[model samples]
Target: MSEWMVTQGSTARRRARPLSPLREYLRDTFWFAPMAAMVSVFVVWVGAQALDTAIVEALRDEGDYDTLDELLRFAEDAKAVVSAVGSAMMTFIGVVFSISLVAVQMASGQFTPRVVRIFVRSRITKATFAVFLATFVLTLLVLASFDSVDDPRAVTTVPLVQSALTLCMVALSLLLFVLYVNTTLRLMRISHVIARIATESFRVAASMPVSTGGQDDAARLGSATAWVPHEGRAGVLRDVHIARLVRVARRHGVVLRLIPRIGDFVVPGMPVLAVHGGPVPPRRALRYAVSVGVERTYHQDLGFGLRQLSDIALRALSSAINDPTTAVQALDRVVQFLAALSRRPLDAALHRDRGGAVRLVQPVPGWTELVDLGFTEVRMCAIGSPQVCRRMLAGLDDLLLLVPPERRQPLLRHRELLRQAVDRSEPAPADRAFALHPDRQGIG
Candidate 1:
């Protein structure tokens, strides 16, 4: 391979790492807790040693006063103080972790398993655990200093300053513990989770590249050309490096059509992309240009966020859960996300290189497909529930007003489907009529 190809391959691999759930869990902030604790312990030990030297020198140079006497007393009781701090910190760490684990378990059970990812990735939770562990490590280090210098007349026997600093840290940890509790409570709510997902999906939809409705020159070329199959393990397609793929395509003087859009699963022996030109780019270079993972991430996959909220709503509407209110809230957010999407260009599937030459042609779901993904499953689950049916109809009607003329047809179609669902599910004409019309509370 050429030097530039090697450089591009490395860079693409770095950017296109598949953020699967296990990878995400291992990469979460809590995983760094031990490193934080070790660093804290090292710094605290160095600082304590320096302070011990300074205090001993000050006492030696200056006559002993009442303040000096108090310092001496603390030094004498340094082991006890360190022991107490270490013990207390250990207890606090256990309590905090227990509470956090309980919250995660409750969220996973009551909500969706996907919701647990939010808590695991929480900065507050990670910082809480890191600080708590650091405090314990610092105390143990301070406690070890007692064996280093045992003579009262020594020039490195004072530990008052270190003890005071550790005490202040304890206070900070306690404050963080309170804030963590508040965050846990807020995250447990269904509305907050749906809103967060909606906001993120909106941002992702808006960030998609704009296209000029240009056709790929390689589209015709790929029909008779050789295809490049994925040679890696099976996984979800998380991201694609369009720029690098374009560069490779341009360099090879051919058009490449990616077989899978973001979030689709691909396995070894499946075609990853089809080549238009005779010879394809290096296999390693092309493989590095795409990211595959065990699960999907919202980074570049537009379907992921919508799928999460839809799944949550569908679960809520299930007979086992039977929480129509939660489903309604999720539908409300879905409507907001669809409205935001309608304003953006959803047909930007053609990607070009730096020279504005189209080299990559991949399929992105049009607005209609997205609408179907967001509403289809939820509507099916809501067929028997008047509250859910009303909410879905109202959402579709509201979306129809916001969407452009081209997009309004799909919304209208979904609305009719919802109306039919109400007709079939509600036998009484009066009850069915009430649900067929969009109402805030589905009849109330």
Candidate 2:
């Protein structure tokens, strides 16, 4: 009877370790970069100021009086320019990002709220903000380093190095602004959004192990004991710490099965993982392996990309928007996502240890689930648009050729559903028949 219990030690005493909020904060927040920029500016200022002082001292020793006078004049003149540049950057940050953020909010509304997340996580967006702040700080430091010609205090005659660093930062800030504007503009374009999401999906797919065939032993863990309960704030399961879990499981010579799929909402007290084939190891290790956040991320959740694409298509098909053209464009990427995976081997669920023994069984989405997730909602909404209808049919047909025969069932079922939807959408015999014909380019 004791053997049936997943945990061997006292259950009440041990608790699972919650994933690090600091790690998640760094991963998902917008302010980290700008805050980091402040620190970076100070560090650079220290080093560059030292160099400037050393160079000034050496020049004075060499009796370079003419160069010293010129540098002093330049430093005096640069004060106002640096001051203006510093203040202008502050205004630039507030105005540019405020407007861009508002635009991002609009894009999120038009597509999915995921757009804002994508925007926040963008390296260019972060870099632009960081550099802008760094430049502003650099200017401020440069201004401060300038000697008061009125001061009878110890002062570096020429703040040449600090000024040069300021100029470089200012130039970089300008270059990054161009990139930020371009990226923001691209976010507003539906085609670009879809392409970006699809590109991410492909990147995730490329990391996952390609499935040749069966994960036969995967189901052996079905009757396993649910051992670990979530100990943190309830939210969407973002991703699992796969390497850690596998390492721990291999050490214990046990198999760990994740109970919830990535992207599933997990609440406190929910079973995080099931212990299969052996005694549960330390609860802390298992608990720390999972990350839960307010919303889903694309890191390990393959469906998120398709979900975003479908959302765009659905929004385009809405009665208010009634933009079938945009809907068709969204469907283009949906087809591309399915088509890419159709030919390539899908991911395997059973994660193996270095010794080739099964250590973890992840609940990866099967082809059927992927098919349903990719096409189901759009199919229902797309019926009214002949453009969408024809494109979907053509897409299913293309997937049929790419997938193996055993994988053909779902595609055929979707094809049949589309035919039925066309029948219902086009009451006229000729119209229904025309809509049934597969065309990748919609009407063309």
Candidate 3:
């Protein structure tokens, strides 16, 4: 067994380290959007310049009077073409931006507000923005070369080929805009949203290794320990640097116990980590390894995805919305996610160093806790809603059939709880019986 003790005066207060600069820079959709557009602009400019130079050289070699005149005439058309493209692309950018903002607003109001981050981070939206912006820049660059033709002192040059390239870019942007519209429409649908979240949550679950019940053959933490107090402002603890913590603990030959699980919040003076043998490592190094952010992320916090759908279900169940069907759809996703989680072991995790020594002990939510997190609140909020309650019962049955028998006990208990809730809150005996029967389409 692990012995634990914290000295009263041993708590060290240190500010949580800020996120790495490079990571912070890359995570923002705004940064990547402009950077991609700028790179595209540069590449298109270089290609256009090369093609224009080759055309000038070819024209000089031929020195054909008729061809020169035709080339000059084409330059006039190229200028008009590029100018139109530039104006049109600028307008398109504004229109698409407005549409994206409206879509985001609707999604936030309909679903959970956190999902707005998903829309902004969408690759389709970013790619569309990049292509349109790049087209605008290419047009401007082509227009700049028009002066080369007008100048008598310089060798006669025309951007006939580059203008054709700009025209091609215009066509590509239009195609992307069509796809963007399709993606936006899909985002608006409730079924699509629920499915997307379930798929992502399943992916996150698949990435973890099967648990050995978190048992460790190595020694556990002794009574003597140093408590590492939380520093800085409070926020969700999104990730832990278990590997690094293990390495540091092994180097000092001590066990480090992290108090909060991923997705937990830590405020000032909370014991974030307990060091059980050596003095605590430098505050900055330890803090750098732990990530605390404004909101929960899917990187390692699997519960965040479920929370997103749960919010949508709760919103739909609101008095103003009163959309039971939408809540039922959300419950379908909840069942899928919980079924996936049921296959894996969820217990306190123990990470060891290369030397086979237990260096890090971090707490994790067990299956019962996760089941409660995923279902309790929504079921409670959905008490009188027959469609929602029946859907929940059906989901519980499906999950009971899907997962292994060892996991079936909890599902069985939860199913009983749902029945009891329906019995108490639902006044109609016939309605309660229908909900208790577990039909996918609910009482209807």
**Stronger candidate by TM-score (1 vs 2):** 2
lDDT of 3: 0.75
Candidate 3 structure quality by residue, lDDT tens digits, 159-201:
7778888888899999999999999899888788787777666
lDDT of 1 by residue, 1-444 (tens): 132233334444333333344555565547675676669667877987787768777876775555555666677686687788899989988988898889888778767887777888888888788888888888877776654444445535666767777787788889989998888778887777787777666545544555745333434444637788888779988777777788889988887888788889998899988887667778867856777776676767777787888889888987788998988888777776776667556643677777877788876777988899899999888887878788788888788778879789888888888887778778999988877778766656
Residue 160 displacement in candidate 2 (angstroms): 2.0
* Alpha-carbon lDDT of model 1: 0.75
Q: How close is candidate 2 to the true structure, as a TM-score?
A: 0.88
Better of 2 and 3 by TM-score: 2
Per-prediction RMSD in angstroms?
6.6, 8.2, 7.8
Give the clashing pairs for model 3: none
lDDT of the candidates, in the order given: 0.75, 0.78, 0.75
How do the predictions measure up, each by TM-score?
0.86, 0.88, 0.85
Which residue runs of candidate 3 sit more than 4 Å off their true CA positions?
1-21, 148-155, 215-224, 284-287, 401-413
Query: Could you give the candidate ranking by lDDT, starting with the highest?
Result: 2, 3, 1
Top-TM-score structure, candidate number? 2
Error of 3 at 126 (Å): 1.1
